[model samples]
Target: MLTNVATVIWDGLNPFEFGAACEAFGLDRSNDGHENIPVPAFAVCSPTPGAVRTSMGFSIEAPHDLGRVAEADLIVIPAMGHTTPETLPDGVAEVLWAGYDRGARLLTLCSGAFALGAAGLLDGHECTTHWMYTDKLQRLHPEAKVIPEVLYVDAGQIVTSAGTAAGLDASLHIWRQEYGAAVAAQIARRMVVPPLRDGGQAQFIDRAVVEPDTETFGSLLEWIVENLHEELDVPTLARRSLMSPRTFARRFRAETGATPHAWITGQRVLRAEQLLERSDRSVEWIAAETGFGNAATLRHHFTRVRGLSPQAYRKRFAC
Candidate 1:
């Protein structure tokens, strides 16, 4: 349902992230031989609608000023290198605050999340930035829940992406939600990128670390993912890990940052999402397949977690 789209960019912006947003939303691909590609109106706005230098020593012009944000259905903020408290652009925060208040979704690419943090929009939202900047974002916006290594966090009205490539992931995610899986897939094909990558996919914060299963819960998490359809109660998992239930609960939270039940429910919801995307199976069957026991329970949990019912999700994502 996105109509008017705009990017509020700043000086020293990273071109790749800005380009990622542009490629996803700004470009007119009607001539790309794809049918039913919904294109939204696009613009680039800035504090000053003039020459803006990029981090790579080049400049791009912003054709519109901050006033244009008031008409946008979605606003993008691409990375401006490493932004701190002092470097927030003049009058940017006020416009973003106004935009969010008016129900326009705000999306931040990479360290552009710092701009949202500056605007106080990230307060109490589970947002993220480039992994290298996660700690700093949390420190600066202490009220924000900054997760370090996820591709992006979609906080309903605000979506924040991590790292460089994660911006593309976020962009495609928005497409999938607003359009449908099929349309987003066609767009991805046009762009020669993967069709879809769920936002929960991990960001490559650093090279993988090899650690013992006892410390990292690496083996346990793998097993949990594989056996999501089975009864994954705490006692059963505790026995599998050769620890008391209390110790297992503490360890599970320490390693995964979610309680055992919550993590398992999240995994089940992901499994449900995959099933919804690939098949026309009945919700009752999918619920049992994903260990939700019945359609009503599945509906309850899926609606709570995904903000849509199983049927609605299938309508949006099923091919």
Candidate 2:
């Protein structure tokens, strides 16, 4: 349903993330070889029709103004690097509130969540921010329930993402809900990023079953991810972690919030989804590589988790 999007900009915006928003929603594809593709498109900038400086010591100019947001389908707020809590300019909050009241979708990227919080849009909403600012957002807005573990939280009309790259995942999720997985996948493919990153997965971090003081589970988790093709059960995983099965399961759940079986199945399903969309391999081949043992097992679990057969998913999301 989103045919247009608007990005709000300010003096100290993070250019990379601001550009990510533009890249996802603002880019014109009329003649970019996607001439026949239905792009979920376009941006209208904030307050002015000129350039804005970024936190990265660079600048980008907008071709439009905040009025553009008034008429758009969605409005995006990207992170601003302003140093003081009270430094936000006069009327910025009003602009945001006005947009939301007018029934436009309001989304915030990372620290940009603060702006939404300030306007009371996030009040009583389950939301998240860059980990570093989770406490700050909470301290600043007591009514907002801040969730730290999620990559993004979609409270229907109000969406907020954790940090820089997480904005990609959030944007794609919106695309999926509005346009379907096919459009989301196509947009992701054009960006050369993963089509789907579950909001529940831990952000890029180590997953080793180690104590807080000396554990280095990141590398170990990477090894597990790479070797997902091997048969892995609790006993085998416990052996690798040098713990008893019960102890390992307890610790793994504590660390990842998922039981070992759930984690493995989720990862395998995620891998299968990627393969289904990105490769021409047979179900048997993908099943073997993703540790589902055989095509039948893969099909069963894939359909169970995704509510679609592998062929159906491929037909919808694959190029």
RMSD of each: 5.8, 6.3
lDDT of 2 by residue, 1-319 (tens): 7877878887888887787898888765666666634554576475656778778887788777766667776889898752233766666677777877777788888888987887778889999888777888888889999998788888867999988878998998787656556566678888998776533435333453233321634555677789889978999988988889999888777665567787788778878877887789998999999999999999999888666788887877775
Every candidate's lDDT: 0.84, 0.77
Per-residue lDDT of 1-319 in model 1, one digit per residue for the tens? 8888999987898899999989989877888776578788999999999999999999999999999889999999999866665788888989999999999999999999999998889998999998788889999999999988677889999999988777887888788778766677778887888654432324133344322245557788889888888999999999998999999998776555467898889788878887888888999999999999999999999999668999999987676
Residue 27 displacement in candidate 1 (angstroms)? 1.9
- TM-score leader: 1
Stretches of model 1 off by over 4 angstroms after superposition: 198-203, 208-281, 285-305, 314-319
